[model samples]
Target: MSTPQEEQARRNAAVLQAIGAQQPAQPEWPAQPQPPQEGDLWVPPLGPAAIDPTATAEEGAGKLSLAFWVLPDAVFGMILALALQVIALFGFMAAQGLKTQEDIQSLQFDPTFTLIAAPTLGIGFATMAVMRIRLLRKLPWSWFGLHLRTIGPALGWGTVAGFAFLAINFASGLIFERLGSTPDQAEQIIGPFRSASSLQLGLLGLFIVVVGPFLEELFFRGYVLRAIRQRLGATWGIVLSGALFAAPHALSITTGFIGLLAPIFIGGLILGYVYQRTGNLWSCVLAHSINNLVGFLGLLAALSLP
Candidate 1:
């Protein structure tokens, strides 16, 4: 009884109803952007590709290429540190009226050289390291293992590990001394500690316990080691990092009685491992601070002894 047009309209409506019944319901809200899948390279807002959180083991090996890792963080860092140290050294010499090379050599044993020069070098190293990581890597400071959540645990473990290392070092030194294999490097290094004024001592302690550790751990473990680990895997990364850590202290090896290279190398390995395990910079820094603290206390105690 319906008109032809009405019949066609009804048929169309029925067809549409059947299609709607088969189709899935629309989401109430707009769909969120999907996260990058595993094996996907993450392009940072700036710079080249950044770290992939879910990268496969093989892909991760080349996540940080050698050119980027070594040039900015390692080589440039060393250059910056050296340049700053040279400036500091010259300034110190000028202030003290030291003209000859011999005069500078003598001043090396002075508190100003140890306290001021060493800290200046550390400042330069740390500043350059931070700049490189932030600018070149296009990453935040937090990427360098600066998370607040891991601080307490990192510090606690670091303290324990540091004291243990000190004990081992002490025992090794005693054994070497008994065997007449050790030299008289302690006097050369610690002599300044004995003669320094209370103010100087305090400054030196501050550098050793806080500034030095923070800077060193931030660079060596946070940046260099992390990069190497990402590329070369843990074993090579830890070893190479420790070697680099020890390399700077090479001069001390010639002067110290027991030679600091082995202990420092071992310490570097331990610190690198701790950082790798915890992914926390504070842990290594605290550990380094504790190690320095023990040495500081020992120097104080020795001075106090009659």
Candidate 2:
């Protein structure tokens, strides 16, 4: 209804009012404050997990980097010592002329049992000594799990297997007697076969129960079996070690023939299997002890029979 100029002035004023309403009075910023460079913002670069580079597979189970730990070195050292022991045994046997029946019987006076024990113990000591060397060098004996838990099973199974071995021997002896075949005497067989006084028997039993098992387990199952397993496959390791185990019995003149060899071979197989399964020496030791005990007990029973 107003004049044209008045109408134009009103429209312009309304446009100005709308523009003023849309324009912000001051700039708004993000709600979060910027992180401090020294505190929260500094993220260091991450590399691979901390592990030694020289370790074997057995040494680096869950490690990020493969590294040589102390255990493998110690174990290798033990193998070296055992190899040396075998050579020494061969040398000594050759020197003593322990080939024929007379030579073997004569040498029994200076028992291989006593001599072999020294080298076996030395191997164990040397392995532990090598581990100490690693420790001094500030290397990883840290990762080695000295599992005492495996002892129980080792002892239990070793005893059982040992008893089984004795049973086999007794049965074999009976079969030989029935067939009118003279049994060849093996060292272990003779060692237990010869009956001294009751005191002597008791002492021998003690040795069988304790020392024999410990020594055999250490040398055969613990060191020999484990080392061979590392090189050969486990089956080969068990078989070869078992054969080697029977070699000591070759000293027996009367009973060391093919007949006795069968049982010894079979016994070795059982023992080697036990050692492989347990990963502990105690089981083999216990099994060996129990086997000897069974033999001793059986002998006494036979002697006492009316």
Candidate closest to the true structure, highest TM-score: 1
> Candidate 1 residues 1-306, lDDT tens each?
999999998888789898875445676998776787898755544322233242132222234464255435565666777787788788888888999989988876788787766765566557766776676556667777898876777777777778767876777677766766664445555766667889988887888778888988887887777766656567777888888777766544355534466677888888888887777788888888888888877777777766
lDDT of each: 0.71, 0.57
Off by over 4 Å in 2: 1-147, 174-182, 186-195, 301-306
Candidate 1, position 61, lDDT: 28
Per-residue accuracy of model 2 over 1-306 as CA lDDT, tens digit each: 799999998888789898875533587777865554764433223321112121233322333221223235445655766777667666777876667677545544443433443345445534553343343333333222125776666567767777778777777777766766544453444453354456655655666567656655555555455545544457876887687667655544555266666677788888888766766666666667777677667656764555
How far residue 23's Cα lies from its native spot in candidate 1, in Å, is: 34
TM-scores of all predicted structures: 0.72, 0.50
Q: Give the TM-score of candidate 2.
A: 0.50
